[model samples]
Target: MLVMLTGAFGNLGMATAEALVRAGHDVRALDLDTKISRARAAELQRTAARAGINLDVRFGDIRDATYVRHAVLACDAVIHHAAILPPTTEHSPELARAINVGGTECVLRALEELRTPGRLIFPSSVSVHGPRLHERPPVTAATPTRGTDEYTRGKIACEEMIRASRVPWVITRVGVSPDPGASSVTLDTLRMLFRISPKNRIEYVHRDDVARAMAAAVTCDQALGKTLMLGGGKGCRITHYDLIQTLFDALGLGRVPFDAFGDESYYTDWMDTDEAQRLLNFQSGRFEDYQAELAARMRPIRLGLRPGRRALRWGFLSLVRPR
Candidate 1:
């Protein structure tokens, strides 16, 4: 199978590309950087050479009509991972709309013109479900999409565009996971409140699981036109308290005061990924296990930043001595 992956050089995009090749599929990776994409393509080619797998990476933005048309027309299926997501989108609303909405429109339009039976897997976000204190667990595909953030709004709008397409498409509304790291208000506020919050349950999935689900959805005809609320299906759910405690423990930060105002709205609502499991053969492990691996990966950086952290702690102590 020939798979076209958008946002190819990104964290998730690269993971997906590598996974697809390892699964024995030829991949064409698309990214915005001409030079970087070419370099990445060479790297992938070299990596594949060592592993007996082959991948082609190209440079292109989904916003360009001509590029979208030319690129999507060549692949057997398309994984639309390209989008202007958070932190950045929160800063540049116009760029967010242009890329998230306009770029998506271009890709869907191309799919319409090509009139090919290509499978499209769009990576939507859980952010579409607006922040609410009464947020419930196991939110399903049938749940309403009411976004509170601009990033979430853009994602919902883009998904709407994808749904309007005549081509077969599967929308996976994904939750926060380690590919992006925890930069949410839930994480920050909880850390500030308690050295940990052991009660607030949160939903998340690893980037690897996300990519696997996306790749699996491509050939799974049953997944077409379906919206899947994906998460770390079984061992995926954890409390912010647990996560914070785990982080502190891993970092050996000692005891710290943690507070929780009992505001569920600060975190993402939980969801059952049964549909994702049934359709995409989803496999998600414990978030703690994912975190351990992340910690392991941070070993080199830990050495690099140890002094800075100590200095910051010292500076904080100096500022707090009843000045």
Candidate 2:
């Protein structure tokens, strides 16, 4: 299969592209033209070259219908992973909507208008099931959606559009999947983290795991027109406090007080991923694996900043003001 993947240079995008290539499928990757993206694209090319993977990478924005249509040409499947996530969504709602919702509409229209035979694998977030902290343990595909913010609203809209269209599609409502091997953490991400209560139940998945699932669904007949939940199984399920503690431990910062956490309940919970796991077999990664990767990545930095560890721990308190 020749798969067309949008946002083909982000952490997840690059991972998914590699997974597709490793699976012996040709990849047509599309993403924005930026210095960082260019660098990443070069890296991806090198990786593919070593593995002898067929890769065609193009740089373009998804908001343009013509470009999206042209990008989708001659592809066996489309794995749409492009979106503006939260904190960014909160800061710039219109831009998020334009890219997350409007851009998705462009792709959907292109796929429908062109009468593409292959399926679409869209990566939606579990946050669409709003304020699930007080609800049950595992939310399923049939769970009602209640959008609490711009990002969730956009995801909900895109999912609705895909279902209504005549296109063959798979809507994967993914749990919290962060790249444990990330070089650096963003301030916006930290701010968003600060807004979620530490007590909230979180079913986190690894980026590689999600990418593998997305890659598997590209060719899996069982995934067509199905709404599946992707999570990291038992080992990945934990409280937000546990997650933050692991992260802080990896980064050389001791856990902070519960008072530092947000007052309100957030939309995080363990996802019932039995159907997805049964279909895609993508729940092999565990949180311990993520912690080890993160710790190894930050080892040098942690060593260099060992003297300021106390101050650094206090510095995180700066993310929250008197509230």
Candidate 3:
């Protein structure tokens, strides 16, 4: 299968692309990384090559209908993971709309024109539930969307655009707490809320699980027009404070003071897994186990080694670091 992976240069994008290549699919990556750092480009190239896979990297803004059309025309299936995420969206709503909302319309139009049975896999977020925690109970695909923040609103709007498209579509409403392999808002919030041992509850999933669930949806005829809520494994639940303390203890770092200004929006209400398990045979990992792995990886990095610009430079290199 030829897969067109949008935002392939991003953290989640890279993970998904890597998964596709490993599964022996022809992959092409599209990102607005026209001026991507030399280090990043080289790393991705090397990583792809190491896997005996070479990805065609196309630099184009997704909001541009022409560029999006061209990219879609070149592939058989589409992993539409591109979007403007938080904080930045909070600051600039227009950019978010132009990219997240406008980009979806462009992708859908491209699919319609191309007349391909292209699988449109949209990795949506739990944020669409809005920043507010569910006062009633866990959230399911049928839960009413009430996004209070601009970023979440943009994501919701993007999905709406995709739904209106007359194309094969699978939307995954992802939960918080990324696998150790991906950058996570959950980790950052935990660090901020409970430097010593912050206590809270949240859902999570591994990046690998997310990537596979998406790929499986491509071949699952029953998944079309379905929105599956994906989360970590059954035993994945953990209190926020306990998770924080565990990290602190595991890292052997001194307790750092933290203040809690609860952002209920950060938490994704529990996911309904029945549909996902049945349709995609999806399986996810618990945050605690993933955190343990993260802590282990951090063991080698010298303590108190505050990252500077080199971190960004090195981070770019790490993106495509030899598998």
Q: In TM-score terms, which candidate is top?
A: 2
- Per-model TM-score, in order, reads 0.85, 0.94, 0.80
Point out where model 1 deviates above 4 Å.
34-39, 50-54, 180-200, 260-264, 300-323
lDDT by candidate, in order shown: 0.72, 0.87, 0.70
- Order candidates by lDDT, high to low: 2, 1, 3
For model 3, name the residue pairs that clash. 43-320, 131-265, 197-241, 198-240, 198-241, 199-241, 200-240
Off by over 4 Å in 3: 34-41, 44-54, 131-136, 179-200, 250-266, 300-302, 305-323
Using lDDT, give the best candidate's number.
2
1-323: candidate 2 lDDT, tens digit per residue:
89999999988998899899888888888999999889988888888888888788889899998899888888889999888876789889999999999988988888887755568999998899998767887899998999999989999999999999898999999998877666766876776677778889999898989999999998899889899999898778999888888878887888777878785678889989998999999888888888888899889888988899998888777865224
User: Which ten-residue region of model 3 has the weakest summed lDDT?
Assistant: 256-265
lDDT of 1: 0.72
Candidate 3 lDDT over 8-52, as tens digits, reads 877777778777877777777888765542345567778778888
